[model samples]
Target: MTSAPPRVLTVAGSDSGGGAGIQADLKAMLANGVHGMSVLTAITAQNSLGVQGAWELPAEQVEAQFRSVVDDIGVDAVKTGMLASADMVRVVAALLRTLPPEVPVVVDPVAVSKHGDALLGAEAMEAVRSEVVPLATVLTPNLTELGPVAGVELRTVQDRELAAKILLDAGASWVLVKGGHDGGDTAVDVLHGPGTRQEFSAPRADNRHTHGTGCTLASTIASYLARGYDVPSAVGAAKQYISGAIANGFALGGGIGPVDHAWQFRGSGQ
Candidate 1:
């Protein structure tokens, strides 16, 4: 038998729409050449339009899924998304703490859906800040999510950098403040870490069906990290991967659709 490929685990909710959350993470991971696993934290009655209803799983179930995967298959990296409640956030953080120090963890602070529907509870904000942020190897947050977590309104790139600093200081080894909501000809994402900063700008894809951009980017980063890329290199590679995915996004339903995670393979006949 051949050797196993690098493994990455995503701890997130299930998106029934298959545009974001665990579905997106797995797709991104596979696109970037890693075996993806998941620990489902919640189930959402979501579609292209918006999230209709959501049910958070018991904390014990979440923990059990995590343990069952890690104890047997093992993992090279991990990414996290929508933990519905404060209890779930704490539980996920505690589970992350049990991982080896070297395993990279990418946390996508997914507070809301692409259509502006809330995915995380307001009560979970503090739990995420106090418990989850610190455990993250790389924290990925869009401007709206960053504003609340960093307690500031971001209007410029400088503001984003400052917000990134706040998250970095909160204990995340690196913080990527996404500029997708900034609305410009260029989409600039700022990655800030200890004594280092990098700006990754991609031609803002003129596409509206970019529903899974956040989850895809975070999982791509985790996938690259699992492939042994350094933090900066991993993030840089993920930026390129996501830009392509966004540029190739296609309409799925009546509302927004998903980025094509298999964009690279589309015309290659793979």
Candidate 2:
């Protein structure tokens, strides 16, 4: 028999809308050719419009789910999103510390949903900045997330680099600063790590169906890492993948829709 596909595990909240959080992460992982697993941190009552309700899982439950996956199936890489509280962040961080150092961890510092729904609380933000963030192998933070995590409002290219530097100093081995909110003709994302810096740019797709772009991008990166790609290559490929996904995005509900995860295998070959 052939060997199993690389496995990528996501620890995050579940989006009932199936557009973001754990749902999007798993979809992205599968699209990127990895076996996806999840430890649901919270259950969300959400739709295209926004998140209506959210209930965090008990820390014990989160631990159990994580242990069940890592202790048995094991993980080649990990990604995190929408941790509901500071306690949850700490718990996940501690667990991540126990993983093999070779396993890359992509941390999507998800603070708010595309519809402006607050997914992470203020108190939890501190925990992310102090605990969860420092453990990231590759920290993927969009414009809005970069500001809160790095303690600076990023507007210009210089500002974005400054924010990335702050995150790098904070302990992530690398930082990918997403510039989707820059309102430009080109969508740009910068990847920065020790003695290395690169920018990946794609023509901005004028699509409003971009609800889960952040989660999808981060998950794609983690999946690539699980497949044995290095950080720069993983981030570059994920950028291209997400660019195509955004272009292929289609409207679903009355509100924002999600990025198309399967654009590559849909015959167009992306």
Candidate 3:
């Protein structure tokens, strides 16, 4: 019998648009040859335009979901995004602390959507900075979202590396500071902490259908981690995967769309 694929769990919010949040995380996991699982922290009324509404799941429900999965299916790695509230962040952090610390955790502290919708509140930002990031195996934050969590205002690529340093100092074993939001010819992401310092650069794909790029990157990284790849290698491969996902992304709605997660499935063997 064929064995099941490695499992990767994402504890995040639901994106109704199916572009970002848990939807994108699961898709990326599957594309990278992993079994995907989720523990949703909130439900987002998201669209290509923006997030219209959001409802956070009760802390009890979040804990129940975590226990249900970790107690049975058991994940090799996990990625987190969009906790929605301070209480939710704290709850997830506590639960994660009880897990085997060796299980890699990719924390994507999603503060805002690609369409500029506010996904995280100001109060919750502090919780993420203080509680969530401390347990992260690798913290992936976009340039716009980096300041609150990493506490470094960025103006250039050098600034982004400094921001990564701040997050590493904050307790993450590694920091992957995404430089896509910064206007540039290359989309750069840097990972540095402990004994690993890795940098990824891809020539800008010039695609507007970039709504869920951040989610895809973090999920891909976690999936690789689940498969037993080390931090630098995992981040490097994920960078390549997401860049191609962006290059071939298809437009679906009037506003921003999502990356093409299944690109590797195309073409006959050569």
lDDT agreement with native, every candidate: 0.91, 0.91, 0.88
Q: Find the candidate with the highest lDDT and give its number.
A: 1
TM-score of each: 0.97, 0.96, 0.95
Candidate 2 ranges with C-alpha deviation above 4 Å:
none
In angstroms, the error of model 2 at 66 is 0.4
Question: In model 3, which regions exceed 4 Å deviation?
Answer: 155-158, 267-270
The better candidate by lDDT, 1 or 2, is 1
lDDT of 1 by residue, 87-167 (tens): 999999999999999999999999989999988766797789889999999999998899777767877767877888888
Summarize candidate 2's per-residue lDDT along 1-270 as a digit string, tens digits: 998999999998999999988999999988889999999999999989999999999999999999999999999999999897889999999999999988899999999889998777778887898897788999998888888888887667788789888889989899998889888799989889999899999999988999899999999999999998999999989998999999988788899988899888785533
**RMSD values, in order shown:** 1.6, 1.4, 2.1
Q: After superposition, how far is residue 219 of candidate 3 from its true place, in Å?
A: 0.5
Residue pairs with backbone overlap in model 1: none
Global local distance difference test of model 3: 0.88
**Residue 85 error, candidate 3, Å:** 0.9
